[model samples]
Target: MDRGRMELYNLTLPVGEKHHTLAFLGFLAGDGAPAQAIELQARYISRLITGKVAPPTQKAIKHNLETIKNFSIVRKGKFTYKVPLLKLCDLIACEIGVYPWFWRVFLRDPVLAFMVWYGPIFTAQYRLLGPDSDWDRARAACYRAYDVISANGSQRDKVKVKRDDVTVARRRQVLLFTCGISAMFALGYLGKSRNLHGAIAQWY
Candidate 1:
């Protein structure tokens, strides 16, 4: 395959499925509207696919269009988009679950590992709860992380297990407080301890 198709294959479905291409196309279609105008170049899309651009720039959008053109995946004429015959093969490859082999090799990078693991958690925490939110929100963020762990269904199972254990520990503390054990210590021991010697002197 050509470089642009290879890049799209590598970026969206580095693993075993081409679902992300549909996601990309859906993004382009924009809620039943025609695709947005391209404002950026192919290099920008390359940056986006590689994770260099977090939200992707207009330049990146243009780059995606150009890449599709270069790969003959789509033809452009009279300012419109058209799909061709070989493009059907590309779609089929996506549908049948073929991914580039390089992802397995590149998984060794630590930064990529962190992104695959904790990136969504951090992103959600910052967006939904903000960095300065209280511990309750922070803990909820961790719970979101736990959900991601559960959904992925991989060796990351340990992450959810650990979060579950922590949640249980917090629940136990809440139970103790509800039973008045914490309040009892404060009212009984602490209150009496402060006045014990004074009360003894009064008795004398």
Candidate 2:
């Protein structure tokens, strides 16, 4: 395993020795109760990824979920049970290079891919672009950061900065800015979707 190649596709599995996080993404494609059904969902996703009938222990799934949360890949709401898919974070996980992993997931199951794609973008547009949202202003800041990073090196070097632990640590300011904005976007969509009507938000 190449420690320097820490992008999503190359990294070791977070649970069940497979892409359980991809499975978790599929679970979030619907309006499922994530907290309640995550264990069962983890089993189903593990089976799909590794072709293993056996499920990982609950503790392992929880640990992985916690790790992902720490990464700001998924956000839990305070009132509503819905998890904001955090599209930007998902995009950044691919590390400014190859297309997102969700796009690859699309080849195997277009419908699931569509839901995952549609849900996050829709929720983001609906909530993040609302009149009260500062997303426009936020994007400007992100672009400025993007400019600074782009100025520092070529695209290849940028990729190295993203994947190499030593480099990312050295460029901690950029990493934090990326993470901080993602959290803002995630938090912007956090709240009850009581009136949200769509396959993405109310597919129960």
Candidate 3:
């Protein structure tokens, strides 16, 4: 799961493909970062669900290839901006507390996911404001904030994503499911989503 995420960024410098995920685990462990703790736990759960296909020694050697071929992640497509874009947007909606994971919602309630992902005004009301919010004014405020962040940060993003290979493709569905858990930490730093404070209390 950790390896797949660094791959998603298409990380090229410092840690090479062979060692980057280990580097990230080092980042988490050296500092006792809460995320790696959670990841390690999730890995244990994964072992429960699928059981190990290979022993620890062979699994360490084969690594991502050994795990990913078992699941539903993109084994066939070249990576694209749309993949990350949708993933991140869907991620925000899930993290903000008013919605479940987009896929679950799409199955149970596509209308809600559509309103959250495809409709910015509706997205704002549920994401930022509670159900009792004054729709027009609250949504207008959220739109303004989005515009500011979008325009301000637009220049800083430089990944030529449309042409990149799908570096972070997961081999296991459980890994993909748990993989995005780390992204919640990032989103917790934004907006009012403060759920990660417990996980990160020591570091902060």
Candidate 4:
């Protein structure tokens, strides 16, 4: 799963790959970060599921990331233009919640997962706007946010996805399955998949 994500980003092997995911996890674990506790619990669940495929020693090595015991904050220049994009990620993260790790190992509807994860974010947002709040409007506002992120971040252009690869390749089924998982995660986050599923569905 981690290697697939690294390839998706075209990151240099070994050290570069570890740095990227670790940096994301670091930010996620920061103090007052909404995802801190969930990340910890998810990491535990992830190790349990991976136990089916990995030996105990390997699993221990993989799961043995440093526990975050101290918290700090550093104020920096803000990019106002990206604020909407940030909100879009927050919405999707809230909608997906911690279940993607489990979902990757189980059969479940991604749509249902959204509702199951919706209670908290919706309540908080609903309170901010009181009775006048509108769900559709909020959805509309974030509609292009994903597009913007995907457009800028995707490595699809770099991969040589031939016509035959889509139609006649031996790996067609795997590609399609990956694309399906990618689509599901597009409704969520590519990083959520515990397998080789990518964020961009058109990678093949």
Q: TM-score: which candidate is best?
A: 3
Q: Rank the candidates by TM-score, best first.
A: 3, 4, 2, 1
Model-by-model lDDT, in order?
0.37, 0.38, 0.36, 0.32
Please provide, for model 3 over 58-135, each residue's C-alpha lDDT reduced to its tens digit, 9 standing for 90 to 100. Answer: 334344332322221353353221222233333223322333334533343333334445543333434333222354
RMSD of 4: 18.4
**Candidate 3's error at 15, in angstroms?**
13
* Error at 79, model 3, angstroms: 4.9
Ranking by lDDT: 2, 1, 3, 4
Candidate 1 lDDT tens digits, 1-204 = 244233333133222333222223311211122221111122234444666545434555456545555544324442223334233223322222221112231232322223334433232222222122343454455566666766686674454435654685685556545545654564577556778556434432
User: What global local distance difference test value does model 4 have?
Assistant: 0.32
lDDT of 2 by residue, 105-183 (tens): 3333333344445432222222122222354453344345445655664555444334565663455556455656864
TM-score per model over all chains: 0.19, 0.20, 0.22, 0.21
Candidate 4: tens digits of C-alpha lDDT, residues 70-145: 1111221321111122233333333224222224312333332332243223222221122223434533433344
- List residue ranges in candidate 2 displaced over 4 A: 1-46, 49-54, 64-79, 87-204
Residue pairs clashing, model 2: none
What pairs collide in candidate 1?
40-58, 40-59, 41-63, 42-63
Error of 1 at 190 (Å): 54
TM-score of 3: 0.22
